[model samples]
Target chain A: MLKVAQPDRPDALTWVFLGLGLLLLPVGLYLALSAPPDVNQGYLARIMYLHVPGAWLGYLAFFVTFLYSLLYLFRQDPRHDRVALASAEIGLVFMGLALVTGMLWARPTWGVYWTWEPRLTTTAILFAVYVGYFLLRGAIEDPELRRKAAAAVGILGFINVPISYMSVKWWRSLHQTQSIDLTTGKIHMDPAMLQALLFNLFVFTLLYLGFVRFRSLLAALEARKEEA
Target chain B: MKLPVEGWPEAAGQGRVGVVRRVVLLALRDLRLEVRDRAGLLSILAFFAVMLFIMALALGPEEEPLRRAAPGVLWVALAFGSTLLSTRAFALEVEEGTLDDLLLAPGGKEWIYFGKLLFQMLLLLPLAALALLMAAGLFYLPLERLFLLFLTLVLGVLGYASVATFYAGLLARLRGREVLLPLLLFSLVVPVVLASVRATTGLAEGLPVAEISDWWQLLLVFDVVYLTASALLFPVVMEG
Candidate 1:
């Protein structure tokens, strides 16, 4: 009655992705340095230019994934799951970026590369949660059950987003609270810093959209293959 | 094999009460079987007790560190013990083909999910309560925070039960359900795990209520969020 994947629908996506794929590094570099030097931390907090945005966008992708997962749960349409899986994979990728970029930044600023600082620890846990999500999905054989299990994790995993957002306030930790979110930090930023942060936020938001669309397109293609 | 959602429409259109009643009834039946067999409850309790006992030996009678760790140890024990118990719930059902029949009953896939989750909480709460008592008494903590302890256990188990039940349903189609169940369960329960541990540990340490309020709030939020999500996601497992 319903088709899970329809790969033959078109090849337009593949070409568009190829073009975008070539452009990632240059755009990433542009966003990385576009921000001004931090007065407090100097060039180091500049790393926030990348880490914060990656974490922000990862949550955005997963947040969207959470809603569509509900749709899959509510509607029982495999396509919704395909979209969610796509989003989660990208979420996972961006989480990794957040971690890596944060590490590179942390090494120069925080002295030691890591601590169980609430924010960093919570972010790490989120990554583990999603990695475990993909692992559970891969281990299961029944396709429908795989979708269900992943959706369950998708929803559970996102619950961490708010906690991550609030972790600094929730627990005393070494990591400085974000200069932005009202939950943890002093909410004022110099206009230039705020401008750079806002710009990077927009760029990352665009990046997330591109990644999810591409990943979902790939999911649709993968489903089409299974159908074939 | 019949799915639980395909049964008679006797309670049709009765709204929330009817739905809740059906869910409670389903959970009650499972609980009865569990009690009679003593398999689920005994196994879960045995696992929790044995693990706690082992940790006591490992950590020695040193009170300070043990008190610091008491909350986390108890939660970990309960999480793993219930994982073992609830994995068996569906494994036994699938083996007996009862799960298929249950799946065919009246209601949506969510009723089955909610029922199993409720049954899990019922199954684990007492054992968790017992373990918390043993740990508190042995560790020689002031017994004044029993209410707080109770609150922590309720919210923690609620979170764990919801997650474990969802994974059990998901893992029903896979072999080696026991191993896969815990792996899937804890991987997703970190937020709950964090909130619960902090709440319990703070209570054990006799921290002021104002200091630990954040964790309590976090636990409540986690329970609501995960339960709602897993309840909604139940249908996906059913379709598979």
Candidate 2:
């Protein structure tokens, strides 16, 4: 009888990256929060440090998923599928973080927990699409078929992201908050504040890479067990 | 490429004719199956009508509110109805294990996808017509812009059927997909639904065609984009 292989431990690189993220996160957070309150919005705008990077990484993770999904179809390798799934899972988590932080940011600024802001609405839809992706994966019993279907879903879902952003933008103009004018591609900020924001963005990106690598290993191990 | 196979004529002629023949035959096959088994059709239409009734009750019988809300309610009912039908779109194939048989016989996977989309559109025809009549009665809609309303329905139905047909095949092999289908489809289909409702509302309000053109254009773009994507991807999904 074939024995099921155990789930692989996160290797040295995973640990190194994760450790760097763990050590740097609080320092980055402190630096981000240390920026002086905005002249117009005051302290409420500080949430941008968390919210912006979270949103950027969220979109980045989905792009990675799309890339791997395309590669999976082309390469016909289960490893690529595993990477796509792991990236999507992490992407969804990042998206959830972005949404919550956005909600928190919106409350004092927009005067409501939610508004039909273009980015917010598009993010909500993105969240739902990936939720459906995981649901699809869970619903299918056959591993090979599930991977193929999921890769297709990943591709389709990514295609919708840009279209959703464009449609929502056309549906309404950017609600120009004090700090960011997404429509004009102009972000007004002091150099120190920008430094803090960029630092957190880097930290979050590294964290995303570490998480996906670890998750993909677990997925690969699971596939090995399934095969056995 | 010349095919030396038995019973097949000129390869170019076969390629050109085969696709149309396959699409029509598959569509007819599905339509015939529906006619033979009217239960699904009747139940789905009944469900649609009842939902409309419930919406009318919920919004109350007042003419002003009903008139303003009519387009949104109508599209909601249509969306729900089409979603119901799509969930069962592949039930027959799954039950009979004939989806594979059809795949094996296909000129291409796209023909099967288009065939199913055509069949769903045919099924929606009477159902949508009845829903339109019901909405007109319940909400006192004007008859002047009937053409635009009908156009919106056609485009809306086309876009919805395209996306829903793809999902139907995707989820056909999964367990508990009946619930999953709507959850996934409704969110992804927001642009189509939003554009349709807005266009219909503008028409109902007697707005000039220019005012509603944005929504109309959005619907057209959505229909073209989704219909093409569904056709291209359907084979990969069904085969996978």
lDDT of 2 at B115: 80
Model 2 has an lDDT value of: 0.80
TM-score of each: 0.80, 0.91
Q: Residues B176-225, candidate 1: write the lDDT tens digits.
A: 66666776666567666767777776776678998888877877777787
At residue B188, candidate 2 shows an lDDT of: 77
Worst 10 residues of 2 chain A by lDDT: A178-187
Give candidate 1's error at residue A92 in angstroms.
Answer: 1.3
TM-score of chain A of each: 0.77, 0.89
Model 2 over residues B1-240: C-alpha lDDT tens digits?
Answer: 111234424434576577877778877899899889899888988898889989899997788999988888888999999999886678889988988887666245677788888888888876787889999988776657777888888988988888899999888877898988998788778887777877887787788899888877877887888887777767766763
**Residue A63 lDDT (model 1):** 80
Which DockQ value does candidate 2 get?
0.40
